[model samples]
Target: MKPGRPRMKNDEKQNLLSAGDNRHRRTEQEEDEELLSESTKTTNVCVRFDDSPSGLGKTLQTISLLGYMKHYRNIPGPHMVLVPKSTLYNWMNEFKRWVPSLRAVCLIGSREQRNALIRDVLLPGEWDVCVTSYEMLIIEKAVFKKFNWRYLVIDEAHRIKNEKSKLSEIVREFKTTNRLLLTGTPLQNNLHELWALLNFLLPDVFNSSEDFDSWFDTNNCLGDTKLVERLHTVLRPFLLRRIKADVEKSLLPKKEIKMYVGLSKMQREW
Candidate 1:
């Protein structure tokens, strides 16, 4: 979980987008063009937010996309988002505040309650999105398996840096085809970290550790051009990254830093 500064809650959930919401309709061509994104053509919107303003604007865009697409196609969603425990709460507060029309169930509660919600209340045929945390997945994997989820989102995915970690291996085992990861540190300090992330992002594309090295060549930290090409070919469409400072440089402060050396008293005397 990451550090957070909480916001005031109004308890008023906004009607962000209505399914089959004909309120603001678009043209067929417009719909088709948007649909070409192909992966996220669901009643929900899933995005990986980077430091970019577009990253922050995903929720609004998701609402817009959902409005345009779900309007064209008569659909009711069980659109789900799985995030960190800390972020899950933020998502709950944000979703309620911004998208009241969309139903969201927070899955970070006690195991009994979560299990109860999963078994009794969260009817896959009826309930909308369920916002859950990764740590809860081990606790609620069986409950999660109940639904044929339209979307899956893993925020701060860098937590799964080690391929050997139970959480890391377990996350990749989930069945959702449409996956979005939101992170500032998508990769660990090393390129192997990138491999672990890519493994989940696109399975078998990188294939094995041998293939990863032949393809990625992270030993020297200089990128393998072919690796970049392969990434563009196989996994390019799914991943989108917007680093901080990409947009709105004016809003943040800019400072130049320099490393300085000081002489010891004996050296100064000499």
Candidate 2:
């Protein structure tokens, strides 16, 4: 049999994780140490991007960033990635394939199954990142809010365009130090929708919709070149837009293959 790394007993694991529990009381010395350390910690902001062509490696870039933070920056995180239900497994697979060094866990399954996972893995801090579906987050939000996440990433972030959305509201309540929003499409909708994303990223700066509108009034001048340029200037610091053709020249051009098959008589009838 192949040997494996040592595994901790569940009781030992729970005891170790409990030390970092948010509810644990801290001594005055510990608080002072934290205050001193805060100044040296680099603040991470929301990384928002759009206008990228399909297959532009958005997911790959995000995975690499998490890997970098964990391995190089020494920020072995308890990150949370909220993705569409359809892509939950795919994200977990990519994390394992590309950055196996970082422990990635998926919070999924039935209510009973999920509860067991939370008790055994999630609460024990056995993972560096937790990848879960939007629906699962809704169901187990309270459990998630317990962690002070290093990064809160949302795939298909357009789902939170509406500030009033349940997902948006719930995500805003998460105790996360950094956030990343990944979307394949541009914010072609109204400015308010764009503000929703910004608000989630930097609530202090983009706190009021009225204020945002007053600065960039696109109500009557949607096509105003100056307005577009100004908006780009504001977004340049936080946004990164890239195209596959521009950055991925080494990749071969896409090729299509078509196959045709006749349906059986019974299948066609159905």
Candidate 3:
């Protein structure tokens, strides 16, 4: 959850994407092409946002790629996007706002409701993508495992930094052809965490943590030149970093209007 931000009320849910901005739309398209090319060329794609900022359009780009694949590449997906429970509807709204043609379903609610969704909607095989929470994925693993997913995306991917985590273990069991991880945090310092992410992305390439660790040992090294170089070489193909300043250059800096108020006698005492 975002710090200092209150939870969104049911009636307050709105389209996350900007409306009628041709320039922003063009920029998003260009970035989507880059993301599409990179994702298709490699088995695993990691979109890392260095600084979380509004209007970077990561969700839009991902949606666009799904749409492109469905229409242009002839890959009408049985895709799955696993997100936090709070942002489940946010993702659904994004899919509708960005790529309304693709059928996206949300797997949530009570047990009976979920059963109805599974019976009526999921089993029909009419949906292109399924947006669900981490808890739901675990609860319905049996049902999810039945399908061969085309794309499996995990937002806030750092939650699986530990290879032994329940979420990590469960997700690996699913039959997914393509995997994409979206994170709005840095993953540079911890080599083990980095390896865990890489292992998830390309299990064949980065299977051994011990070998990976020994190869880039930072012990007793002056500048860690070799380690840095190796890290770059390994990450260059799979990781696409979007810095807030770089992607949102056209966006204006937020203006803060400060106000000073005199404290009352009760306020001061408290």
Q: Is candidate 1 or candidate 2 better by TM-score?
A: 2
lDDT string, candidate 2, 1-270, tens digits: 111112234654365356553322233444455446654765544344455444538777788888988765667787888999999888989999999988998989999999998888877766788899999999998888667677899999999999898988889877566788998788773788888898888776788999887778877447688887888898777777775677668889899999999999999999
Error of 2 at 1 (Å): 33
Report model 2's TM-score to 2 decimal places.
0.73
Off by over 4 Å in 1: 1-76, 186-189, 221-236, 247-249, 263-270
Q: What is the lDDT ranking, best to worst? A: 2, 3, 1
Candidate 3 lDDT, 1-270, residue by residue in tens:
211112233322222133332111123344465357657645443444444344546777678778977876666678899999999888999999878999999999999999999888887777899999999999998898767577889999998999999899888776566899999878766778988988888776788999988877657223788777777887888887777766777878878999999999999999
Q: Model 3 clash pairs?
A: none
| C-alpha RMSD between model 1 and the true structure | 12.7
TM-scores for every candidate against the unseen true structure: 0.66, 0.73, 0.72
Off by over 4 Å in 3: 1-56, 220-222, 250-270
lDDT tens string, model 1, 1-270? 110111112321122122232211223443455366554645435444433335445444444433332344433344556666766677777767766666667766776777677656575333456777778887777656544344566667787767789877666655443555666664533657777777766654544756665555565335466656765565455566555565445566778899899999999999
Leading candidate by lDDT: 2
The global C-alpha lDDT for each of the candidates, from Candidate 1 onward, is 0.56, 0.76, 0.75
Q: List the residue pairs that clash in candidate 1.
A: 14-100, 79-129
Task: Give me candidate 3's TM-score against the actual structure.
Answer: 0.72
